[model samples]
Target chain A: MATISLGVFDWLVIASYFVFVLGIGYYLKRYTKSENDFFLAGRKNSAWVAGLAFLSANLGALELLGMTGNTFKYGMYVAHFYWIGAIPAMLFLGIYMMPFYYSSKIKSIPGYLKLRFGEKTRVLNGIAFAIMTLLVSGINLYAMALVLRTFLGWDWDVSMWVSALTVAVYVTMSGLMSAIFTEIIQFFLIWFGLFLVAILGIGEIGSITEIMNRLPESFNTLWSTSGDAARNGMEVTWPAIVLGLGFVLSFGYWTTDFLVVQRAFSARDLRAARMTPIIASFFKMAIPFIVILTGLTAIALSNDPGSGFSLLQDGGQVNYDSALPLLIARYYPTGLIGLGVTALLAGFMAGQAGNISAFNTVWTYDIYKSVINREASDSHLLWMGRVATLVGVLISIGTAYWAKSFPSIMDYMQAIFSWVNAPLFATMLLGMFVRWVTPNGAFWGLLAGMGSSFYMFLAVKFQWFEAKILTLSSVQSDMAVNFWRAWWAWLICFAVTILVSLVTKRQEEKDLVGLVKGLTEETLGREVPFLKRPEFFALLSLVALVILNILFW
Target chain B: MASEVREMKSIWFLVGLVLLVMGGLVLLAGVVELFSPSERQTVLADTHPGIWWGAVMLAAGSLFYFKNRK
Candidate 1:
């Protein structure tokens, strides 16, 4: 492995990219006319910007850096991330859940709840979603800082603050519009930069086929069929993969996560909004090649971890966050190395900015407007949104720095989201269609779901529930611990939501039709036509792409 | 009836193609072992299933790419 320092060429390309993105922020600043314009990009962003934003948010360095490292350490079952976990869930949400939000015409997702349910449900969702943004923003900013520090020896505080402030300035300056429009530039660099790293890396690995020829027989077992232990401490046993990654993580993220929803909510029309995630879904299916390849390549070049590479763990684990940047600095040539850095930075900003911008909007419109100051003027609300974004960015930076103390940033973020996401969905769905779902139901469901899940999380954290839970004897390793806990968390939250909602004044629980029918001032009601011709064309192309994928390998 | 049969046959062809690839990959693994047996790879093998999976993904993806629409 070679250590190539960042040269003048690399700096120039990266600095140029930064200038271009800031320029986009400045250019769009003037067009942000009213509160709507500032908040929602004047309700006019195209599919390309929306699509890129959706993808870029997910495309964060977390996956490129962290998941790539996982891929390097673990085998290819990482593909299950998109295939089993996200693809189906994405398509399902696009067809089923997205239309519910997009057509309902809510400014943000929780705003839709206010219309369908009551104010309490909206605020609960708003606050829950806001907390999610805080966690996500923190992780993303932390990751961005880590990438720079690992590469350039930049100070953590300086790196985190520089990136966070840039994102906040633009987002505060505009809103989703600024964040998304910048994504167009960011995604390009991320792809191009990653592609460059992969090409050079494969060459270093002594051709794709030669590397493939040396692979373990078990690695080819599509589902970890050979029954091996996950190297980097993942509790992915065989059956757990069937239920955990395949079911819960997939269903939970696609069905409930608002990062994707915010994108859907931002689209210009139903079709664009609906189809954007589907397109991004399929596009994501290709990411393992780039992210995972960089990971494995890091392994091949570093030659089993203990070689003092510092980038890789001796136990075949690469520092999940450093894998991508280390590879770029090690393998890529001068100018390209700089480009790669820019791209990784772009990936980080894309996630951090989207999180901050979204959290700010949610706080201002959903929680602040409804609960704190119901009579705030449009101008005042708009100003608060901008202020919230700035504060959100600062909190995110602080949290990112704090998260460094956690053992695994990736696992920590996922675990926290799991505690909250499923339960929130319970409240949301019941409030939507079940008109009789009382405001009390909303209140109690939030309390119970959050309370029970928190208790379950703590119980598992302390191993307090060892008496009743199932053991991992069948799985061949200790992998089932995380899976069992994930299931229990979602289950307990969901059960609490339903029981609390059903019993706490059933009179308030309105029927499904009446509640949803109340969601719009628009239509006499028409089902979103089964994705018009263009969308179907996109779907078919996506399928073809999948089939081609299977055949090609 | 003819169109249905045609579609069905193509579906099976696609499915069979998949089975063939899977079997080939398994066979390839066997060949690698028979040849290498005791050889430890020092050159760093990038054989993480993801690369090959990415290629197979092209097949899975083709199912989604529609040609029927304008």
Candidate 2:
């Protein structure tokens, strides 16, 4: 067994990265003098900045490492995450939803839900979102620690705590402002580091064709293999791809998750905010080339006996999670290794910071002030925000350890996302598009949706069903469980919301203005310029995605 | 009018400054890698990423920094 160690230069690079990030946080401290500044960056970020942060906030170890590993195991089928799953939903958010979010002047998604549904619904969502963010924060911390323990051979606890403390320091100081600024920097580092690995790996393999020749024919194609569950390198059928992930999970995350939407909310104007996710989708389209390609290159190199590389664990099986780290240690030299590892560290920290910051905002505005102390002053709220950041980080550290109990962390995280996000999005979609969805309907509907999802998860995992009722032919076990859970949950939530709304009194039409789809035409995106029209960009993004799919196919 | 112009100028100046600093460091790393012997290069790594990407960054920085300079 070979061990990869960091040299002095690597330490210097890592140290400098820490200093630069903390420096940005300290420098931005002056801007966060008020509660508004702490939560929303005073709504001062430009569209490009907001867009980059929007993209970067999601560019954590989950997307980078998890997707890379999945691509290694699943082949081109994994591109579904970036292309079909993300692009259309992001465009929809920018075109249709941003107007409502920006015009409403709401602090969080729960705050908006309160306006549309009622207080109980808001409280439920706020608590759910808070718990989900902590879980996600823990995933980032744990995944980074896993990678560090694999490469540098550090203790998991040490790696996890050190990473958490660094993120806690910056986020607690200047709030989201600091997280956004550092995310912009981390975005660049992640790209530079990944691009270097991709170029080198592709160069080694000779060409895309050369690399493709080494893998099975199905591995090179994306959509074609997805038609059959068993034919695709991964057992993801087109139905599951199109509906469960592309429709449900993607919309749930890009549209409703406060972590990313909050970045869009910090934009300077309605137009800028509208442009944030659209611009991100453009970059999101290109991410797979660097991320997924690196994984494929690793597969090709590791399979060749002469390459002197194999990411195999005991019993000569591939440890998919170690794909990216193994590639970094194999390809990059001493000094450059620092930059690559720094990029990974930046990704981990930025993700944790983004989660903690979102958690702080939701906790302070949605939970703390609304429920705990309604009469708190701005200064007092600001202090509470900092306190929440600390608490969020500590809880996340504990959740990081708890995450070890799961067999596959990525699958577990996605399953949790499916449970909460799908139902919340169903309620959100109904409340936003249909004005008649009463508060009682939405509240009970969300509860039923989440409840059914939880029951389905337990039933499938424990083999409670004698027959294969929940099983889908084309989808694998864990993902199949997730997709079915989300699909049924969304259905139950939608049905319950509609059923209960029929029994309850509806809100006045005047009050529904700018909140529902049909009523929002005047207030939403009334002044989009020719160049800034979201439809134009959406069309362009879709075209690019279609072309990539065809080329890969 | 002068103040608005000054504000825009400052924004661009800051952009240029950040670009230059980041680009310069990357370019420096590239130059060092460029001088290393060919034997030191690995098959699994890019032969000249530091130089290639560094030059690109340098060009972008120069364009932004020098284009609007007094």
Candidate 3:
């Protein structure tokens, strides 16, 4: 594609979005008068709002750029991240897991750890989470800034600073509410913009079948990628996708990640809170159409010479991340180009703000209040929350510079998940379900799991071991390697926790009742009126998921 | 439903209003591009994505805006 220039209209569209974000923060500032208000929006969000925020919070540049690039690189196998990887986990969180989380009334996942295990587990997880949140924020900041510089010919640092300052100001001013409010807007912008690309690209290509016909046979099938590494474009087999990504990594993210869970925590009531993830699942089921299809379209365009995409590098390798922007420039005219760019900016900002907001809450409630000042006033805590948001964004900016070392933003993120999330999820699963799992078991299990995952990560990335356990021949790509690492790490944590729990003292039954599954009765209490029942929503999402899998199979 | 709406603050109304305006501007732009003969070939081929997407946004924004209007 030729050097694309933005018109006055495009700048206006982006500027207006920024102004609207700042304006929302200013308007909501007064409502954030207390710690509860600042961190949880006083638990006032309705189901629809919370659900949108939940989906939007996760729909940042990671989904826009990272997933799109991965889809371009890996083909249909990348859709697993949304479908089998996310949908079931989201429903499980809503239908079964959220009651423990909501009823326990803890502010962060680490807070729940303190109640279930002890200070050791809580502090260890809390510090790790806080650091991880900052790293994730930095990854998002770096990814967005890089994409903007590539697409618009803007200075990288300038793009990074502008985004960081915009997110920081509103987030500091109105806290989580601002981040969420902006996220809802972003949700719309991103969908519309992505829809524009998908619809136009499909029109240009004639149909999904036509596009598939033009691409390699390996790129067309989702389940068929497993037979041989040489044949599978993704270098991942079905077992890896099902066991590694679908079971461990997916559940780890949707069920436990405090960044996304914070949206549900902000819901007005238990029903709405539970409904949040379910509603998000419905949207999650459709995301592949917007993201994955665009990547496929870019792949089709790149393979056909004289198609004007120009995404190929020196080694016959596609600059996979450039797929989204190249598509935008290819199809969109001047005015629609503005909307598309706004959508890109919206996704970037939403991701940054989501990370920062989650960082603030975890810092204030989990770390600062619990460790540094146990008896601080709510007002003082609220002040600390603002400070944490500022500090978090600054640290993220530094991390963004560090993040440049990674080959791709998505690879860095999946590696982090392997190290932190797999172990954390194992602990969460045992802690919430198995009442006999002692505090010592949970704490030590987490440490063992995280340590082992990190070691295996280094092993895989460096080809450190000749042993089959250390070397993965089934998976061909670094991304697939990360997935299998998470799987192994989770198993270690699960085993260690069970072994340690049997020898250690268990918690009192009274203390564990509402916090553990099967130990509590009707945790959700009343039925959710037929239409809003989680099962009904989950079933609908599941049906759609099955049909999508079949259609693409 | 009423109770749910009652809990909503003005910030949501602002959300709806912003979407309505943004969608309206985008829809107008799409309409202009549709009418302009010179821009037709250079734009998205045979697809008026802006108008269609703008209408969707208009509907979505209005739902958020008017649902809490009372």
Question: Which candidate number maximizes DockQ?
Answer: 3
Q: Write the per-residue lDDT of candidate 2 for residues A1-553, one digit (tens) a residue.
A: 4456766556766777787777767766765789888999878877788998999999986678878888788787788889998999999999888888899999899989988877889999999999889988987888888788877887988888988998889988889988888787777778766677887787788988898899886677888777767787777678777778889889988999999999999888888898899999999988987788988988888779999877758467667777888778766765567778888999999999999999999999889988999999999999999999999999999888887767366467887888788998899899888888999999999999888887887787677862136544624646655666777788899999999999998889888887888887665444757555767877888899899889887
Count clashing residue pairs per candidate. 48, 0, 0
Worst 10 residues of 1 chain A by lDDT: A470-479
For model 2 the local lDDT of residue B24 reads 56
Ranked candidates, highest TM-score first: 3, 2, 1
C-alpha local distance difference test of each model = 0.62, 0.81, 0.82
Model 2 residue pairs with clashes = none
* Stretches > 4 Å off in candidate 2: A314-317, A405-410, A466-468, A521-529, B1-41, B44-48, B51-70
Q: Candidate 2, residue A226: CA error in Å?
A: 2.2
Give model 2's clash tally. 0
- Comparing to the true complex, what docking class would candidate 1 get? incorrect
The DockQ of each candidate is 0.02, 0.24, 0.37
Cα distance off (Å), candidate 3, residue B35: 7.0
RMSD values, in order shown: 11.4, 3.0, 2.5
Which regions of candidate 3 fall more than 4 Å away from where they truly are? A225-230, A312-317, A405-410, A466-475, A523-532, B1-12, B31-67
lDDT of 1 by residue, A185-269 (tens): 5665576567756766676656766555445544333443425444323435555665655565666666666665676666677
lDDT head-to-head 1 vs 3, winner: 3
